[model samples]
Target: MTVLFSNSRNAQRYRAAFFLSLPALIGLFLFHYWPIADTVRLSFTDYKVFTGEFTFTGLKNYDLALKDPLLLLSLKNTAVFFLIKVPLQMALGLMLAMLVAKPGRDSTLLRTLVLFPAVTSMVVASIVWGMMFHSDIGIVNSLLESLGLPQQGFLRDKHQALPVLAAITIWKDVGLSMIFYLAGLLAIPGEYYEAARIDGAGRWQLFRNITLPLLNRTHVFVLVTSTIAAFKIFVPVEVLTDGGPSNATRVIVHYIFHLAFRFNRFSYATALSVILAVLLIAISVFQLRITRDEDDD
Candidate 1:
């Protein structure tokens, strides 16, 4: 009789929970899953630009993508951008988090300053940074001249353009990363540090062993999100360079956008989108698996 009553209560609670979450579930299907399914479907169909028709072409788009030189170049550039942005962003974010982890007025001010750029519009930020890095009239060049250094063709130089874009984005996005790290830092118990000090553990030892190890989940979450953000780098490239200076910063998303909108090759662009989605999923799964394994060990 008791078991039956318990089961009945559990079922009622589940039904209540489901009813509460029903709207979100419906939104998830309509907005996220439905678009994903349509994108996948479109990937296999060839869209006629002029006629507004989609004819099923099976795997032809995928096969052509394999032989596309521009796609390969974009992928390589995107990888380079990722390498530059993710490492610096992670390091700088962690440093900032550590700096402001303690509760104080100074920490509060510092947090506000750090997050200022994040709240600022990305387009406005991109434009302002682009002007600042201008070779001739920018403040950066003016300072360089005053210091007896040559002006750099920042956004205009093919080799430097991608890195400049990465730097701009890192500045804009690092605040969010810092917040994640700050949360991780605060969640760490004070007792851990006290015990470490009791055992003759120095600051470096505590950070290396206790702090780092305990923040493993935070690291995984931040890393995965940052990696995806890095991979989808687009706005800075679009607003500032538009993949100029010999296509130095022609990252994947920008390329796909140009293909669909500029060139009107919608089908091929959808195929690239599918590829990007799969790549992101695989990378995220791999990161989670690695973190889980480390936890197990």
Candidate 2:
């Protein structure tokens, strides 16, 4: 009779949990899963923009995308942006986290100030950064002049535009990464560091051996999310460069967006979106697999 009662109670708890999760499950299906499903279906079709008709065209869009020079360039540019943004953001974030991980008024203030840019609107950030990096009238150039240095083209220069955008985005996003790392850092047990110290472990040894390895989960999470964000870089390009003086900052999402909205190539755009989704999933899976392998090790 006691076992029967316990089983009944467990069933009731399971039922309650399912009921509580209903809203989020429904929302996930409606917002994320449904859109992705629809996009996949649309990817194989051709949309006649004026006539409002869809004709099934299997693999044609994919074939065209394979031949598209701009798409290739956008993918290359996105790879470059990811390389520039992710590593620097990760390093800077870890450093910032270490700096402000302690409990103090100064640390709290610094963390708050660091997070300010993250909460600010990206469009607004882009506009303000755009103005600051302007070739002629900007304060950056003015500062250079004051210091007897040559004024730079910055956003206008094809060579400088991509890296400049990467810098702006890193400044904006690195704060959130710091918060993640700070949480991970705080979670590390003090006793481990105490034991390491007794064993003659230096500061570098404690950080290298203890802090980093224990934060593996945090590392994977940060890396995967940062990668996705880096790949989808668009708002700054739209506001500042618009694929730039020579298509320098033409990242993947920006190109896909122009294809869909500006040029009204909905079918082709959907195909690109599907490709991007697959790419992100593949990258994420690879990252997680590596994490799993490390755990096994």
Candidate 3:
């Protein structure tokens, strides 16, 4: 009788779990997977919004995307943005996380304040940053004037625009990354630190030997996701700068939008998007492999 009742309970639990997950599975199929499949199908054809018709083009879109000079320039810009921004953001985030994760008074308030920007909408943040970075009569220039420095165009100049956008991206995203690292730091066992202290481990030794090894997984996660986010940055460029000053700040996604909406090159834009998707997948897979190997070591 006992064994029979146990089997009945197990079956009921399984049924409940299936029912609970059914809504999410259906939503994913309807939303994400369906749209992706449609995009892939459209990419192979001559699809335009105005015409409302699509015909097979047999890799013509991909061929055109590869040949486009704007697409190539956008790809280079995105690569440079990612390479410069991700490492700097991750370093700043890790430092902030360490500072706030310590067992001390006021830590909670500090952490909450740090995370405020991350929760704000990207469009709103971009607008605010745009105002702050205005070329003439802006707050930044006003301050520079008071300090006897020349007024500089933060977002209007070709040379300064990309770096300004990169700086804004880092400021807005670093808080969330800090929160992630903070949580990872908190979850680390106190016993490790205790053991290290007993062995007369200095602060540098504690971080190098104990903290880093355990935080390896978080480091990998932050680096991969932040790199991908830097590549996909569109809102700041679109709202704050609009890839301004002769395309100096034109990232890949902005270029893709221009191709699809502005130029009516839907199929070519899809091809560029497909390339970006593949690149992100390759990076994610490489990171996973590296993390697995490190774990084994």
Residue-level lDDT tens digits of model 1 in 92-111 = 99999999998899999999
* Candidate 3 Cα misplacement greater than 4 A, ranges: 1-22
lDDT scores of the candidates, listed in order: 0.94, 0.94, 0.87
C-alpha lDDT of candidate 2 relative to the true structure: 0.94
> Against the true structure, what is each candidate's TM-score?
0.91, 0.91, 0.89
Candidate 3 accuracy as lDDT: 0.87
Ten-residue region with minimum lDDT total, candidate 1 = 1-10
| Candidate with the larger TM-score of 1 and 3 | 1
TM-score of model 2 relative to the true fold? 0.91
Q: Candidate 1 regions off by >4 Å? A: 1-26
List model 2 lDDT by residue over 1-297, tens digit each.
566678779889889999999999999999989998989988999999999999999999999999999999999999999999999999999999999998899999999999999999999889898888899988899999999999999999999999999999998999999999999999999999999999999999999999999999889989999999999999999999999889999989999999999999999999999999899999889989988899788
**What is the alpha-carbon lDDT of model 1 when measured against the actual structure?**
0.94
